[model samples]
Each structure stands twice: as structure tokens, then as C-alpha cells.
Target: MQYLKRYLLICIAFICILLGIIGIVLPLLPTTPFFILALACFARSSQRFHQQLLNSPYVGPILADWEADKRIDKQRKKQIMLMIVCSFAVSIWLLQAQFHLQLLLIVIMFILLFCIKRIAEK
Candidate 1:
């Protein structure tokens, strides 16, 4: 059972890391969330994998800072929020759904923006 759990975590971590790499080239796909997941899973399942992730140039510093401080810097928070908003806006505009769907998306985006703003402020 323990081995199974570890195997699953490693698999998930690998998949997340792959997705994170893909997200680097795809503007719409998020990078941080997947890297974070990979970090977490690797931390639990494999020290070597965790070290490799921590040594990664693109995401290593952010992960290190997050692990050490449990918080993202203000500048990074703002940048992440901007990216999220822009991506959401693009998604909303591209959708050919009904008015209700647009309204719902706007509301959800607003709520998410508000939450991100609050987190960034803190």
C-alpha cells in the first residue's frame, strides 16, 4: 500500500512536471500550479526528483522562496495576477457561448481577481 501510494505520487509528479514544461510554451496553460504540484509530490516520494526540481532554473527560485517563506513576493504576485486576468479575459472573449455564460464567466473572474488581490495585498 505504501509503495503503491509512492508510485502514484511519482507518476503524478512526472505528469505535472511535463505539463509545467508544456505550459512554458503555451500561454493559456498555467506553469506554477503544475510545478508546485510536482514539487510537493517529489518532496514526498523521491528526494532525487525533489532536488532536481529545486535545481531547475525556471521554477527553482520560486519554489525555494515559497518553501522558505510560505509566501510569494509582491512583484511576483502582481505578475501572476496580471497573467491570470489576461488569460481569463482571453478565454472569456474567445468563448462563443450565450450571454448568461459570459456573465457567469465575468462574475467568476471578478471573484477570482478579488481573491488574488487580497492575497497579494497580504
Candidate 2:
């Protein structure tokens, strides 16, 4: 049972990591949350995998900041916010015929901004 649980967690962790990678290209999705989830799973299931994740160049620093203080640095926060705005703006503009979709995108963008704002700065 314990082994099965560990295997399940490891699988989930890898899936989350893949989503995090995809989130890098898809602005509507967020990367940090997925990466963080993966990190949490790895921490619980496998120390080696957790350390390997921490050693990743692209994701390590962000996770390290989150782990240390549960907050992102001001600069990184600004960058994320900027990316969200730009990507959402493009998406909203591209879907001109769909007013409802545009509105939904706007709402999602604002919600994302709000969530980012609420995260305490490190």
C-alpha cells in the first residue's frame, strides 16, 4: 500500500511538472502553482526527486523563493504580472467576435492579478 501510494505521488508529481512546463507557453495557465504542487508531491514521496527538482535551473529559484518565504520577489512578481497582462490582452484582442469570451478572459486576468497581488513579497 505504501509503495503504491508513493508510486501514485511520483506519477502525479511528473504530471504536474509537465503542466508547469506547458504553462510556460500558455499564459492562461499558471506555472508556479503546478511546480509547487509537484515539489510538494516529490517532497512527500521521494527525496531524490525533490532534490532533482530543486536543482533545475528554470524552476529551482522560483521554488526556492516560495519554499523559503512563501512569497515571490518583487521583480519576479512584476514580470509575471506583465506577462499575464500582455498575454491576456493578445488573447482578448484575437477573439474579437466573442464578446462573452473576451469578458471572461478579462475577469480571469483580473482574478490572476488579484491573486498575484495578494502574495506577500519577499
Candidate 3:
């Protein structure tokens, strides 16, 4: 049962990592949340994987900081906000013919911004 559980967690972790990567290209999917989930899973299933994730140059420090204090640095927060805005803007512009979808995207963008704003800064 323990082995099965570990296997399951490892699988879930990989899926989360994949989704996190995809989220980089598709802004609506979100990146950090998935990576965070992956980190949690790896922490439980494999210490090596957990350490590797923590050592990732791109997200490593951010994840490590989050794990330690659950806060993001001001500069990183600003970059995230900018990325969200730019991606949503491009998406909305591309879907100009679909007014309802555009409204939906706008709503989602605001919601994402609000959620990000709520996170405590480091």
C-alpha cells in the first residue's frame, strides 16, 4: 500500500510539472499552483525529486522561499503580475470577435490578479 501510494504521488507530481510547463505557454492554466502541487507530491514521494525541484534555477528560489515562509519577493510578484496582464491582453485581443469569451477572459484575469495580490510578499 505504501509503495502504491508513493507511485501515485510520483505520477501526480510529474503531471503537475507537465501542466506547469504548459501553463508557461497557456497563461490561463497557471504555473505556480501546479509547481507547488508538484513540490508537495515530490516531498512526500521522493526526497531526490523534492531536492531537484528546490534546486531548479528558474523556480527553485521562489519555491524554496515559499516553502520556508509562504511569501513571494516583490520583484517576482511584479513579474508575475506583468506576465498575467500581457498574456491576457494578447489573448483578449486575439479573440476580439468573441465578446462573451473576451468578457470571461477579463473576469478570469481580474480574479487571477486578485488572488496574486492576496498572497503575502516576502
For every model shown, the clashing-pair count is: 0, 0, 0
Per-residue lDDT of candidate 3, residues 59-113 (tens digit): 8988999999999999999999999999999999999899999999999999999
What is the C-alpha local distance difference test score of each model? 0.80, 0.93, 0.95
Lowest lDDT sum, 10 consecutive residues, model 3, at 58-67
- The candidate, 1 or 3, that scores higher on lDDT is 3
Model 1: residues with Cα > 4 Å off, grouped in runs: 21-30, 118-122
Per-residue lDDT of candidate 1, residues 11-100 (tens digit): 999999899888776545567878989999999999999999999887999888876766778888888778777777776787766677
Score every model by TM-score.
0.76, 0.95, 0.97
For model 2, residues 1-113, the per-residue Cα lDDT tens digits are 99999999999999999998898888788888899999999999999999999989999989988988899999999999999999999999999999999999999999999
Worst 10 residues of 1 by lDDT: 113-122
Reference-based TM-score, model 2: 0.95
Task: Give candidate 3's whole-model lDDT.
Answer: 0.95
